[model samples]
Target: MVVIEQEPEEPTRPSSPAAEEQAAAAAGGEAVRPSSSAAPEEAAAAAASGEASRAAEEEEEAFEDALTDEQLREKARSQANDAKAEGNKLFGAGQYEEALSQYEMALQIAAELESSEDIRAACHSNRAVCFLKLGKHDETIKECTKALELNPTYLKALLRRAEAHEKLEHYDEAIADMKKAIEVDPSNQQATRSLFRLEPLAAEKREKMKEEMIAKLKDLGNSVLGRFGMSVDNFKAVKDPNTGSYSVQFQK
Candidate 1:
């Protein structure tokens, strides 16, 4: 099962002309001296423009520098939440790729927010859902693992990761993840059902693997024995039921 989180609406930041002007000024680099052929009025206007641009840049920089750490963090959280909310909307619209990009943006912004682990984890989990929808099972597992790293008890991440593992035929890993999810939320029927379903699959896979290994070993034994005019059929492996151990016996 895949789960996406919807972030609460946060206050939007007001557009600042100063910030836009600062960007334009930076991009312009060294201001071009009003063409030497320009009029006196034009030169004066250019000079005024440069001074205004510098004043805006200084003002913006000062405003940024004056922000306390907590305020800065709050701003980052709001920005991250905005990105996450956009991703959720894109996901709901069935645009998984676009949603993935927004989640990536959220993660990048939230990465340095020490108190925003929940946001980080939710973004990662949302990205995992995108991957899952896109049939990128490996990427889904990676994203879910990242979410789980940030919040180990994240049930959605565990369940989504288990689903990814199952898609890749990694029954044991799927079962383990489902078990962890169940541990994290004992009342989760989904996890309990998943665990029940995965257990048989894991057991079947293990048995199949064991049988394949035994067959390969037999082939190897036969190859070596053939050189001595013998076959693997000349030996028997008997199991001691009490100790669950095997005993190799020579046979005619």
Candidate 2:
């Protein structure tokens, strides 16, 4: 997710003394300059407005004082890439926690710099990889989701999310992500292989879910029928495989 600071509300644009006096005259009150020491509310409002402007100026200056827009963008991208590179190094060294911190730093810098969408997406994907390594499957899914929001065609994010789904046994989601990955990169052998492998597994999960649903319906039916001194077991459907038909039968 893109990070942002909540800005202080803009106090009503400061009214000029002439405008304030005109409003006072219209309201049948004596026009008087609001003394800062005597009118606490007016003073507070003015103070708040000034503070808001100053804060905005400081924030703008912080970005503008150092570099031009193009230069700032370049700096942000470079800094983000550096952090990502360091994170990769830590990940390769099997320091998952440290890697995660570096990836997070990359994300923060990218946000502060307002880096490109690709940079944000890459940072998010790298963070997801760290989560995956740490066995935080759900967290990995969340990070991948953010990355995909930034760049839906991000192949690494797609695969990472798919793997996280697989870990959580969300077979339908895993298969869907893998299918999308394959669509994006038709020649991706790993995606193709995963799709082939997970298809049956997903199908099996679906079959199992169907059986559970059927069993639940049966139980509900039995409960209702029991109230009438009957049960679902009293009736049966005998399939005629040859004719692809079923014959209803009743137990005596």
Candidate 3:
């Protein structure tokens, strides 16, 4: 035989003074009078205030419980859209900081809602534009990255991030973003033009970096070879054109 477990009963609590007074009146006994009328009035007011607060809390809980998930999402979307529209207006007016704040508000409102990724991505991209307008290239890149993380195919985010990278002289990163943007929208002239412009800059930067690295290596080699009564210049490196390999030779 299986025995069922039972919940323990709650302990009885003592009644309040007002409850006792009402009980006494119901029992045909005179209620004990308070020292001052103000005391009872204050106590009654406090009780009423507490009851109203509890009632309000219950009503709010009930209302929230009554709403379907779709209804809540729709409400959040509407709010986010409103904030985003305000941001656009501010951006048009050249109030970049204010526009950023509005986009932030939109992001906050939509962040927790299910299926709100598009709005969140849009807000992040808008914030990136604001940062770009304010000359904050790093922040623009960061916000655009967040937008792209939400929606990798977001053309505006990709373009904005590419622009930010270009501002920071990050030619390779700018070229990569432009390439991705072109992949997303092949017909976009802006991305196509940006990719064309950035490729040359990236190539030049790569060459410059290669030269700098080789110069540093030469300096280090000279430092080590000088102790042996020799210099790096005394050695020559010859490249085999067909094999694409280099061989070092010792010279006087």
Best by the lDDT measure: 1
Instruction: Candidate 3: list runs displaced more than 4 Å.
Output: 1-65, 68-72, 237-249
Instruction: Report the candidate with higher lDDT, 2 versus 3.
Output: 3
Best by TM-score: 1
Backbone clashes in model 2: 0
Residues 1-252, candidate 2: write the lDDT tens digits. Answer: 223688955434337986765666646855445545647888899789888888988888887866687787787788888998999999999998999898888888888765367778988998899899899999999999999999999999999999999999998899999999989999999999988888899888977886697678779989998998988788876778899555757885
**TM-scores of the models, in the order given:** 0.70, 0.66, 0.69
What lDDT does the true structure give each of the candidates? 0.88, 0.85, 0.87
> Ranking under lDDT, best-scoring first?
1, 3, 2
Ranking by TM-score: 1, 3, 2
Q: Which residue runs does candidate 2 get wrong by more than 4 Å? A: 1-70, 237-252
Please give the distance, in angstroms, between residue 64's alpha carbon in candidate 3 and its true position after superposition: 9.5
TM-score: the better of candidates 1 and 2: 1
Model 1: which ten-residue window has the lowest total lDDT? 26-35
* Cα displacement (Å) at residue 145, model 3: 1.1
lDDT of 3 at 214: 69
Q: Is candidate 2 or candidate 3 better by TM-score?
A: 3
Q: What is candidate 1's lDDT per residue for 1-252, written digit by digit as tens?
A: 124677944534437986566556655774424335888999899889888888998998888887766698889999999999999999999999999999999989998888788999999999999999999999999999999989999999999999999999999999899889888999999989988898899888987887798789789999999999998899888888999666878998
